[model samples]
Target chain A: MERPARTESPTIGELGESRTLARILPRLASGDAALLGAGDDAAVVAAADGRYVVTTDLLVHGPDFRLAWSTPFELGWKAAATNLTDVAAMGARPTALVVAIAAPPTTPAAVLEGIADGLHEGLAALAPGAGVVGGDLSASTVLTIAVTAFGDLEGRAPVLRSGARVGDVLAHAGARGDAARGLALLFAEGTDAAGEPDPERAAEVRARHPELVAAQLAPHPPVAAGVAAARAGATSMLDVSDGLARDARRIAEASGVGLDFDGEALGADLRVAFAGAEDHGLLATFPPGVEPPAPFEVVGRIVPAPGEVLIDGRGIDAEGWDPYSGWDGRSG
Target chain B: MERPARTESPTIGELGESRTLARILPRLASGDAALLGAGDDAAVVAAADGRYVVTTDLLVHGPDFRLAWSTPFELGWKAAATNLTDVAAMGARPTALVVAIAAPPTTPAAVLEGIADGLHEGLAALAPGAGVVGGDLSASTVLTIAVTAFGDLEGRAPVLRSGARVGDVLAHAGARGDAARGLALLFAEGTDAAGEPDPERAAEVRARHPELVAAQLAPHPPVAAGVAAARAGATSMLDVSDGLARDARRIAEASGVGLDFDGEALGADLRVAFAGAEDHGLLATFPPGVEPPAPFEVVGRIVPAPGEVLIDGRGIDAEGWDPYSGWDGRSG
Candidate 1:
């Protein structure tokens, strides 16, 4: 979608932080969760259960994203989605977000406006009623977006990782390897900014692989499924940020149970399903005799002994996106 | 203070993010406010008032600080202190902090450990019983620390900037301009890592001007005074993060009242008091006949409109730290 033209808008450096915030703040749509929104030293968010489930994520320019691949809107959306997934993993409803942005002074004010619009867009599409309540802005050599999301559990006990037991069924909600596939495609086609790739060719690639690119750039995690799984008596749960195999191992170790995956149930290439990262899908386990929630597919079953993960009775490598490895995967 | 030797420690690249987080998490001390702490996807913090005051700040390596000057411990302390001050400004007690750190893989694991230690130290010293509940770790080319602090208002209405009325006395808690002075000293003495100043000389400067350096490195804002001012019926309150003149002007504009400062009452140089940044002191306004709260010294008074700030009957420039100005101040 093409954004409206914002011709002759002053750069952030020209307007200053306060004035830029004033312009951006009005563009953000605050919902019921915000008791008091931006303009205060700190925003007040309604904590319905007297407890707040909070998480934070930081995305840096070179390591986490490249401006050549992502628009400012996508960056804002991804940042919100990444942190909100953590809240969803805990079976909480996302309530509000606080963003801290550090960027070079030369950055245009239009980029900030795009970010604000994207934040509202993401909240409306993913977790309705959630909104940005407050933020901080500062100057830095490189662009960075740090977001913290707050959630309300509504008195439901948080689904913890260490709750799975023998005989519990392992299930997942949302896509698996699409993001990794998208990244692979991006790498296959050169990602260098200076390289000569005609705009028409780039557009053709994006149009041809819309789903793949969207998965990598703007993942739509099944946020409501967390609450549904919790309601259905999910024993354990977590977001699949660092691949299914690696993250499944986390639950196995935490719960002291072995997990046996049904290869056919995965419905994807083994390599892709096991090693894909940034899926943002919720992986959950339910007690015996309990049906898995809608949108949640049963992919594996908890077993006794070893306390490890296996697919089709074969052990698989749990290699996933490790920050130190420098492998390309979503950090935000 | 000299830190203990950490010879032969592995780098973050060697340990990876998960292992590094494991090494760092144990060092963070959780208080009663954290219902569920680290190890979870998201932490649960208690909200006594059914609402949470949230704020965030990001510190970048080159623009915000220099590793040559600030140890990882000091960086962590400053990050926490800066965010906590915003909570204090809202007349709320800080409950928990969520930190997101992005550093190059080549960074030392000991540096991460030092940051964790500093977070605990800052919380204990500034807002006792507050602790780090959860965080995200990512790889970045530049070192960055982003912290989001949550606070509890304890049923008291949040003191806002637009609440000052005519005849209100302006009061402040904590020092003025000391941080700016410290920055000046650092610049004057030279900040280049390659240019070595004698250890004796550096130590001599530090010892002779301990307060200034400490203010710049890790400001000890009188956090308790925020709640005190609120309890004493403060009409308006905010943290003096920018300059006294600039921040005062913010209150004046927001509340539609003029402020007149007593030069002698400032107890500091006019230039320093009005133009310095990052002091993190609490500035508040109280109605007539209300003795300003303890530890809060009366510095000025609210008067009929021009909606401006004046010192000793003379209008002053609202010159404060503007990140775009390229003046050194704590961006975090």
Candidate 2:
């Protein structure tokens, strides 16, 4: 039989963002015991014996990261940080990771080395010996890194976002706006009268609150806290990816409940963390009757009301950065 | 310190096949536990109590697949088949998969739906409800798919390619050479009676061997046989990816042993399936003392001799189809 003419060919950009996925999905068959695979925040691969954890995240350099702002090592660290936090959000002990990178043929050996260095530094800080496993290197114009992390459940049922209930006390275990602060600093430096980029200023921000700029560049998610929260009987959990306000909304919607934030609970300095977007900082909920685990700070409360998020008794838009949305304010 | 200008960049293909993985190792701090990560066919992910299996492969349109020869659904199946087989090679039951795709924006929703259908179809054959959990869609020139599959060990030790020992029985399950046959038909049609493009012949061939053509477009891997081999104590496990002769060479190199094949044992009617390629069959090695499981045909045996692969008692180059290598004899 003669093959049909190809009238559905899409343009390059269209091909990149949309058509390819549409073209490839029909071939997949159902899998065994995979509760949630593909099409969400992470892939949930089932582990027998009461442990179900997940690992995921993809970063495209030109689209996801930029050399104008981030070094290769920083990019590597962020790669590990984002995926590690996903496992952490499930309240699992992170154990291993696999990294696959696609880069231009012209990518420098040193840059690749820096990426590995950053991955090592970032992952080492959270889970020792949880190094990079399998990866692929292919030629492309821009850089793409896909990472899959693995974790141990330690005999606890995974704390899922859907488990939150009304009347749950919401608590957080890590600083929030540090990465955002560093980003603000970066924008401030970029727009300064000198109009020159400063490596020193960037380094200083990273040093003072290694948690801040590093949060932006390479967030070190509080992995221990996630496991602790699950053990402490936290009802629902999520790692902050988009933003506190945005991520909290996900849990709220998933649990069919409303979340109320107490402005007073977050110290003034910590409130600044909300201004920037980085990666997994814990936001967990426990039954209203229980006290939060050690070192956790009360940030909000889950309410019976469905589909609403309130801060200081006022509604806030669940807006965060959308890569496709244009930034009208940043142009010269 | 001022960062230096990037004047030196390595080619993607060069870095991909490079053997100097040690030189690429980065400095580390502590806490990461990525034991035995990159530099392997599949990275070992450490689970707390049970073992998990994994495999990954990337498909680039125009390089590994072509839109002219395949529909979107077929492309989807091929992508899934390639990676799923890798998990099967580990002798584990496939559980979930994650697919990352890059394409242009003008793609139709139906195409994506078709792709999803194909993915679901393949997954349904193995395990139901297994789907893509999370994936990122971005813009790129070519349609590229990066798929990662996860499997469960079911309390069995993973069968590695290195486990093949002297005096082991080499066996295979599933079809072989169908894809290669389809390609030959295509090639023959392209070069017709007058040594010119044979578009009509190509059409006729496509009609005659729909199965062979489909095999080339989307292969059906013997996922179950892999688990059966492991359960039956197969010493080494591997899926036939490149070609029988070439993949067998990898087993030999990894095991530091030699393999002897009997042409007669490969199946008297092997050519009836298809004469050339695209048969993603399964190959495994078991202890010499073990009996061949049902459905597994003993085609060869592992030998004490180290290095080199012999087919029908002769040393023949096992190199498969590589665009750069320019049409080796088998491609015709």
- Output the number of the TM-score-best candidate: 1
Contacts from the true interface found in each model, as a fraction, amount to 0.80, 0.05
Q: Which model scores highest in lDDT? A: 1
Question: lDDT value for candidate 2?
Answer: 0.62
Question: A-chain TM-score in candidate 2?
Answer: 0.76
Candidate 1 interface RMS:
2.1
TM-score of each: 0.95, 0.73
Candidate 1 ranges beyond 4 A from true positions = A1-9, A192-202, A327-332, B1-8, B192-204, B327-332
Relative to the real complex, the DockQ score for model 2 comes to 0.06
Scored against the true structure, residue B209 in model 1 reaches a CA lDDT of 86
**CA lDDT of A181 in candidate 2?**
77
lDDT of 1 by residue, A63-154 (tens): 67766566788887888888888899999999889888987788888888877777878888889999888888888767889999988899
